[model samples]
Target: MLRLPTFQLHEPASLKEACALFAEHGAAAKILAGGTDLLPNLKHEIYDVDHVISLAKLPGITGFEMQGHDLVIGALTPLAQVATNPNIQKHAPALAQAASLVAGPQHRQMGTLGGNVMLDTRCQWINQSYFWREALGFCLKKDGTVCHVVEGGKKCVAAASNDTAPALMTLGASLTFVSATGTREIPIEDLWVADGINNKSARPGEILTEIRLPLRDHTHHGAYGKLRERGSIDFPLLGCAVRIDLDDADCVRDAAVSLVALQARPLLIKGVDALLQGLKLGSTELDQAIEAVAQLAHKKCKPLDNIPGDKDYRRRMVPVYVRRTLRAALDGTGPVHHI
Candidate 1:
């Protein structure tokens, strides 16, 4: 059996206390939200962490509310709740669909949205038993310098497997972070950098406390599509999220598309608005435009052999999922997946 390394655990009663503990521990400390992700990495000795600061008791980080045109969600809110919340489902259907498809019932019950947002990039070579990785001389993501996915590669290319990130990006979400120093907010799209070894930009000791999404106008329709090895309990091989805003006459006014599980960060396809704008659903032009946008997404996204599935196969499926997800958004029938 794989055993976790010994570590000091700190349960901070307040968000302030949690930030303080993190500040004190610095790089030696890791934050514990749901433990669905962090605990497995801990058992694998991924970080050599010496301290774990738990946010279980941290106040003001576990609820949802609406303030004017914003849907404010506490970072600690469970994925299960995010999936089923009426407010989220109605206002941000893509996010709700993405949350519902994460892992399985048990994982969703425990994993928090913040944990998913802060999910570490994953690679086939790195997320293995210590002995397995050690025998293979380790990869660049952890102990060694070599990158298995790219020959003589200088940097890691671990895939970002978060389902909610792309959906959040499509909805124009923002995140609030707190630290001993102060509090700051940034657009969800700005939270990620291209580096796969550690994909997030949240400074060390900064705690993500809240997620805020703008109230989408009634003209907005969205969906999330996932490609995985199974119907549930598996990370996506490829994930697509789409948003289509329609005019009063049911013609596309604007559109956005984002794809994940490809590289270090989720990809937001550009020029989608130009392609789909002013096209009414059920028209030949709209159909052709969706195909065109999918082709554009395929061109921009290049899958590597960093995660599960053949990179070529995953790359080929990009346009398929993107087209289907966009169709689902237009039909208000999201979360396209193979059961």
Candidate 2:
């Protein structure tokens, strides 16, 4: 049986207390919202923490609300709540869809949105237990100096495993962070640093307070697609999220596409915004757009030896998923549930 290494547990009643605990513990401490990820890593001995700080009792952190044009999602909001919330479904269907696809019903019930956002993803070389890692002499993401996934590489090549990040990113999302220092807001896309070990720019003492999603205008439509080993329990091998705006005549006014599980950070397809601007969605235009996105994906993605699917197969599916998601959103087909 997998057993976690011994550690002291601390429960903070308020957000301030939580930040203070984090400041005190620093790298020796690991923040615990939902134990879905952290607990498993601990059991595998991948991380040995001196203390586990819990945020179960944080006040003023209840649910989601819309303030002006932003749909504010409280950090404590559970995955199930976000997935089934009527407001989220209506305002940010892509995010809702992504949340719904995470784990099973029981995991959804326990996992918080903040937990999902902060979930640590893995590569084949680094995901193993201590014994396995010892045999392999460790990988760059875990302990070794060189990345096993990328030959002679300095940076960790582990892929970004969060499902919601791509969905939120495509729709122009931002995050609210609270820390002992102060509070600040930044674009969700900017939160991720390309480096694998320290992927997030969030400070050790900062708590991810809320995620702010822009209210969807009637003219805009969006969708998300996840390609995993199965319909359940598996993390994504590749995924796509797309949002686009159409004019009265159904001509495209703007477009944003984000693909995840391909690299250390979600890759945004550039020139797509410019290419789709003022263009009408039709079979011909869509075909051309798909071709263009395919070129972009091919050029942008450098799939490594990680995850379940073959790198070549996963790489080829990027444009397929991207096109399907964009087409569905443009046609108003329906929500593409990750499950």
Candidate 3:
């Protein structure tokens, strides 16, 4: 059995104390949230840190509320709540669908929304037992220089496998960060850099405080589709999210498509507005636009052989999932997932 590395666990009573502890520990400290991802990584010896700052004592970061035109969610809110919350279902069904599809009931009960957002990039080569990785001489993500996914590759390409990221991106979300220094909020797009070795832009002493999602006055429809090996307890081989806003006449006003499990960052498919704009629901024009968007996604998304599934197969399923998700959005039937 894999064993977690030795570490000093620090549970702070408040954010002030937590930030101070982080500031003191610097690079040697790692934040512990739900322990869904972090603990497993620790067992695999992915991170060797001296201190683990637990947020269990921190308060006021575990619920959902509406602040003006935005749906503000506490970072520590359970995934089960996010999946079943009535407000989230009304305003951001795609996100709810994504949350519901995460792992299983027990995992959802333990996993937090913020934990899902901050999930690490995953790769088949690196996410293994120490002995298995040692036998293969490791890869770029961990203690090795070589990248097995690509021949002589210089950068790590571990795919981002978070289900909620694409859904939140399509919902036009932003995140708030707090530290001993102060607090700052940024669009979710800014949270990620392209490098898989260390993808987040969050600073060492910062704690993700909350997530904000904008609410529009227009009619909205959304869906999430995941391609995976099993219905539960499996991450996506390909994950797609679709969002389309309509006017009173049921014509498209704005649209977006975002995907994960493709690369180091969740991909926001480009030129979606150009194809989907002004198309009426239930019309041939809308159907044609959906097809065009799927084709466009297929052309833009290139899956590397970093995750468990066949990369080429994953590539082919991108359009298929995207198309199905878009259709489900229009039909008011959601989260087009395999069960």
Candidate 2 per-residue C-alpha lDDT over 1-339 given as tens digits, one digit per residue, 9 for 90 to 100: 777888998998888888888889888899888788788788777775899998877777759888998889998798999999988877777788788887778888888898887878678777778888988798777667778777889888788888788888888889888887889999987888887776788877888889888887778787778888778877788877888877888888888888888777878877788767777777587668766876786677767776768999988887778778877777766355444
Candidate number that wins on TM-score, 1 or 2: 1
Candidate 1: residue 89 lDDT (0-100): 91
Candidate numbers sorted by TM-score from highest down:
1, 3, 2
lDDT against true structure, model 2: 0.80
| Tens-digit lDDT string for candidate 3 (314-339) | 99999999999999988988989877
Top-lDDT structure, candidate number: 1
TM-score of each candidate? Answer: 0.99, 0.95, 0.98
Candidate 2 collision pairs? none
- For residue 48, give model 3's deviation from the true position in Å: 1.2
lDDT of 1: 0.94
Give the alpha carbon lDDT tens digit for every residue of 189-275 in model 1: 999989898999999989999999999888999999999998999999999999999999989998999999999999999999999
lDDT of all predictions: 0.94, 0.80, 0.92
Lowest lDDT sum, 10 consecutive residues, model 1, at: 54-63
Error of 2 at 154 (Å): 1.5
Q: After superposition, how far is residue 149 of candidate 2 from its true place, in Å?
A: 0.9
